[model samples]
Target: MKITEKTNEGLKREYGIVVPNEDIATKVAVKLEEIATKVSLPGFRPGKAPKDLIKKKYEEAVSSEVAEEEINKAVDQIIKEKSLKPAYRPDINVESYKFGTDLSFELSLEVIPEIEIKPFDNITLDKFVVEISDKEIDERIEFFANRQKEYKNSDSQGPVKTGDVVLIDFVGSTGGVEFKGGKGEDYDLEIGSNSFIPGFEDQLVGAKVGDIVDVNVDFPKEYHAKDLAGKPALFKVTVKAIREAVKVEINDEFAKKFGQESLESLKKMVRESISHDYEMSSKMALKKRLLDALSNEYDFEVPSKLKEMEFGAIWKQIEDAKAKGQLDEEDKDKSDEELKAEYQDIAERRVRLGILMAEIGEANQIKVEQKDLNKAIFEEASRYRGYEQQVIEQYTKNPRLIEGLKAPIFEEKVVDFIISKVKLNESKVSKEEALKKEEEANEPAKKKAAPKKKTKAKKEEE
Candidate 1:
């Protein structure tokens, strides 16, 4: 085996590797001998086939496999000897290869840039803490009570009105032909909830009990069901019953409906839920500001390959949003090139932060463990309520999903460690103020004006 240095540049290394034909022939012969023992041949007992015959049968396949293995081994040896931390898979170009000839290939790889971990004690970040007041809890309870509004039979023998729940049987047809999923029986629909097709509920406002009415409606152009979208449909509806809504009193019985012991317990749960939300928002906001500060502090060459990968992901999402006409207002006026330039900076920042965070985590020996993963997985599962086991099972069986969770969890752990070491200038803020702070943390990225091609970007002021 022979290796030659082709190129040595910043974050990029290229090498030319060669393996002698004897080495390749040796491995192929050894592989064929192993195969000969297990493989049966015509009129030949297992393990009794001639080396020439075995070579004749499997030489090409074995040679290719041997070449690939040799190349991979050589690449690994190069990385090990050079102490290289590749940003992505090394690109292999086989210039020459044959069964009985020397094999040579060019290997090129981008190494991750070395980052110097800086002290974080001097950096002061505002930690917004919002107090969950009793009034707020009461307001949330009131909202829940409103959502739990009970309906009873209307006393007045009058037509259905808004805020009334009605039971109806209907068959919706377009062009006198009934469509799939257009029929329902004794379905409870709350008028003015807008849960049904637009104008479909409004037409039922004046419908009385036992009234068989013909309601005509046009589905919106952007409706989820493509077949029914922008199409006119007539529904032959029979009013079954009308029930007026009454608010459920926020008391013990109301609390029991949610499986809570008492009203106090329910309020406690609400307060905890609100507290968790505010704390999460605070941490997120603090993380953004910290990352922004870190980006400002650290200036290093990012692996161009990583930057390109990140940019590809961001541009794909941007392209999707643009196609949907949902591009951000700040981005709407910018050309694709301009947006690319701006978002390239963002991608650079993200890659920089990720690299910095990873280095810091490694320096401090921070790691994600099985328990951490289990907790995160269980927390995710809890979000789906009754389908917790199914969600857990899906995540447990899917290694890719588990891999996805590892990074964020590790990032969170890294952030926590950083917060512990840094100066957190805690500020007690109103929930709205805290939210505004979170939004402001992102303002820097949106406000940065990226320079055109071949021009250096202006540094964002802290």
Candidate 2:
């Protein structure tokens, strides 16, 4: 076997490899001998086939298998000898291959870039701290109370209005023909909820009890029901009752309903929940700043193969969004070429940042513990409610999904490790202020105009 470097540019490496015919012939012969010990022929007992007959029968199969095995072995040797970390599978182009002839091939691949670990301690980041106010906790408690609020028949003898829950029997039709699932009896619908088809609830606004009215609406183009989508329908509605919501008092009884020991305990839990949310938001903002800082500090070349793969993934998501008519508002006006160019740059940045994060994790020995992974798996499974076991089984069956879960866990662990090392200046701010700052930070930076030099006359006048 012989190997020679064909090209070496940045992270890309190409090699030309040649394997002597004898090596391949020997491999084929060994494979044929192995097969002879198991295979049976028409006129021979099992394990008693003639060697030439076995070779004649399985020569092509054995030859192809041998070629693949040899190529893999050669590639492995090259990788080991060069200490190369490939970003993706190396592309093997067969240059020459025939039975009893030398096997020649070109191996091309992009190797992972060597990233230098920057000093995390040198990076300074501002950590926004939002204190969970008593007002916020009270608001959250009120939110839970609202969910438990009761509804009773309205006292007023008038038409329905927003915030009123109306009980009605209705039959919906398109083109004067009723459709399946278009009829409901005594359904409770909140006037302003927008739960039904667009314009359906609005048409019922002035309807009074015992009033028979026709509510007209058009199904959205993207409606879940394919048959009813984009169709205009008229619902013959018979309003049965009108009810107004009565707010539930946030007392010990209300707390007991939620399985809490007392109202104070419920408020404590709500405060803790709100605090946790704010803390998570703060951590996220800090992590973004850390990553942006790291990206600025390190400008190493990323493997083109990885960049291309990332770009492909981003483009695929964009295409999917476009197909569903959910394309980003900012991206809607951009041409395909413009979007591609913009997202390609984003993909490159992501790949570079990923490489940096991995390198940092490696340097710091950051790891995602099995217990943490189990917790993540359990949390993911819990999202499916009754189908938790099925979700768990699906994830367990798909190693790729498990890895997808692990990647974020591992990345977060690395980010935490970096955060521990960095100097975080805590700045206390209101939740609104913190959120406003986050929004501004995430917005794209506008290019600043160069300051105009004051003319001599203007300066003299001033």
- The per-residue C-alpha lDDT of model 1 at residue 295 equals 72
Q: Per-residue lDDT for 427-446 in model 2, tens only? A: 88998899899878656421
Number of clashes recorded per candidate: 0, 0
TM-score per model over all chains: 0.88, 0.91
Clashing pairs in 1: none
> For each candidate, C-alpha RMSD in Å?
4.6, 8.0
Model 1 C-alpha RMSD vs. true structure (Å) is: 4.6
Residue 383, candidate 1: how far off, in angstroms?
A: 3.0
lDDT (CA) for every model shown?
Answer: 0.84, 0.83
Estimate, for each residue in 350-432, the C-alpha lDDT of model 1 and write its tens digit.
78778888889999999999999999999999999999999999999999999999998998899889988889889788877
Report clash pairs, candidate 2.
Answer: none
Off by over 4 Å in 2: 174-180, 323-325, 444-462
